[model samples]
Target: MSDGPTDLPAPREAPDAGPYWQAAREDRLVMQNCYGCGTYRFFPSLLCPECGSEEQVWGPCSGRGTIYSLTTVHRAPSPAFRKIVPYTVALIELEEGPRMMTNIVGEGRNEAAIGDAVEVCFEARGTDAKVPQFKLAGA
Candidate 1:
């Protein structure tokens, strides 16, 4: 994870998402899988939406996905993001079937399009957290 600016707000860790954040801090991507129904989920829920099962497992992800949608931010929403105004934010559809919103970074980020393949990368947030970001596959 690169040392990002400290002006931006850091994400508050959710009680159910400690493992996920821990994995991110370790530079790994993981998803919650329902052991009862074999369904994968994101955003860390306590119960499985598919079967109402409380049993779930944290599993490593392939860290690969396709760009389901995207937009270029030509203006920063806040002063903290002013330095990176022309950045790309995309909804990535993971191979595990969950869609996660993240930034498209690295070379060719500005040219991202729907259906483009992407791979996960970690970026530093404040001092203690790492945010999962994406870049064009093999770029």
Candidate 2:
């Protein structure tokens, strides 16, 4: 069986998020860092929220985090996800400080709890893209 849903819709690539997606395809995790203020931000904004600086860089992430919060979906929101009902979605607090929403996959996903350690993994989204997901640390 698949570790997570294979038929889920692909993520739309925003112009500023291109690097993040490309990095995912290469099996690496990255986040936007503001050069002006030395702050990291997610969702890949063009301007740094802290210092309002347009200068930014894509930096590597540790790919390690703790589950800040989570939920188990007992019902699929769409037919494509029906086959994967009962999947877990979690808000992961990355070691670098930003939190990201992603699916918790692989072993122990359903039993995942807040504060559980997790590490990044990639799930193919299509021919050219991959989505970052998480699994229990060491699982």
Candidate 3:
């Protein structure tokens, strides 16, 4: 078993995510908040989904969340992920009010449970892109 997050695919940052990527590279998670509708969004969009408003600002995320649901992949649909099969991919509910799809690292596959407290950690693949991953939080 791996002791840390591994075998992650290279992150492909969105065209408008230069600042967001910069934060992640510094080991911080950043998400966009739409000022118009007061909703948080991931993957960085130009328009707010709740109210179709374009007014938005980027800020640092809390990086604390709970595992909402998870699935273990026994087979990789792509060759790039084949080596890392049987890993847990989860949808975590953030404490700051967003749900993100990310990999649950560190603990065993069965160690992850519904509502497990997790904290965000950054994984850098290169000089430009950094990915956000989750791990079991401390007491």
CA lDDT of every candidate: 0.87, 0.88, 0.80
Ranking by lDDT: 2, 1, 3
Model with the higher TM-score, candidate 1 or 2: 2
- Report the C-alpha lDDT of model 3 over 78-104, residue by residue, as the tens digit: 775687677788999998788999877
Off by over 4 Å in 1: 1-7
The lDDT, on a scale of 0 to 1, for candidate 2 is 0.88
lDDT of 3: 0.80
Using TM-score as the measure, what is the rank order of every candidate, best first?
2, 1, 3
lDDT of 2 by residue, 88-110 (tens): 88999999889999989988777
* Best-fitting candidate, scored by TM-score: 2
- Flag the better candidate by TM-score, 1 or 3: 1
Tens digits of lDDT, candidate 1, 1-139: 1234545657788988998899999999988999999988987898988899999999999999999999988888888777667778899999999999998988888788999999999887888998889999998
Show the colliding residue pairs in model 3.
none
Give the lowest summed-lDDT range of ten residues in model 1. 1-10
Q: Can you list the residue pairs that collide in candidate 2?
A: none
Off by over 4 Å in 2: none
Best by lDDT: 2
